[model samples]
Target: MASAAFEDIAETFEFLDDWEDRYRHVIELGKAMPPLDPAFKVPATKVDGCASQVWLRPVVSGQGPAAVFDFQGDSDAMIVRGLIAILHALYAGLTLAQVGQVDAGFELGRLGLNEHLSAQRSNGVRAMVERIRSVAAV
Candidate 1:
């Protein structure tokens, strides 16, 4: 699923010649993401440094070495939601170690999302990276 997601994004970027179309494709991807539960919406789970309200929750099952992350974002910003979906699809089911190994910057570049993102979105991405790293470190 992860590989397919990556391929789809790549294909979409390649097929679209305009940024507007690319942005629409990204929003479509975000729309495909499952809706997060309302109850999980809380200040504790809210991610800082984001231009919009973003929430991240980790689900650790038993004594598993990896943790699954479920994320939610509320914003009119399609790109941000798309970014979150990409992250979720790539790392949701992985272990902490695997999560830490992800080359986020490189992956974003590959998706052609890194350079175009706003500063606030970039900071949010960084914050997410830090949170993942912290969890992995433990």
Candidate 2:
């Protein structure tokens, strides 16, 4: 498997050792992302369980078992937006089979997100993961 894009996040977290600094890093990641165009921000793409308004749109390509997908994600909250970027980093280049086989929540703990996020935020993240996985399952 290709190294996960968020592994850089884990390494960066390892050095900080403080949730506040870690959270600042998360916000920075969100700040660095290109804003999602308003046209793509529609009801059909909304993620249902996030506390913040969130959207997910995926473009799938290739054929048969070799199919791969790339996703676009956005959230109104800065932290949630950072989480969206993390999800994109982890998932964007993967084949559907690869996406289906991965454990998304485990990666959260690995990235220090599981420790820092509140229960609501964690659940929101899980919902986002499910949204991506549901798309891959199809």
The segments of candidate 2 whose C-alpha lies over 4 angstroms from its true place after superposition are: none
Task: Work out the TM-score per prediction.
Answer: 0.81, 0.93
Backbone clashes under 3 angstroms, per model: 1, 0
- Candidate 2 structure, TM-score to reference: 0.93
Off by over 4 Å in 1: 1-4, 62-76
TM-score of 1: 0.81
> Ten-residue segment with the worst summed lDDT in candidate 2?
1-10
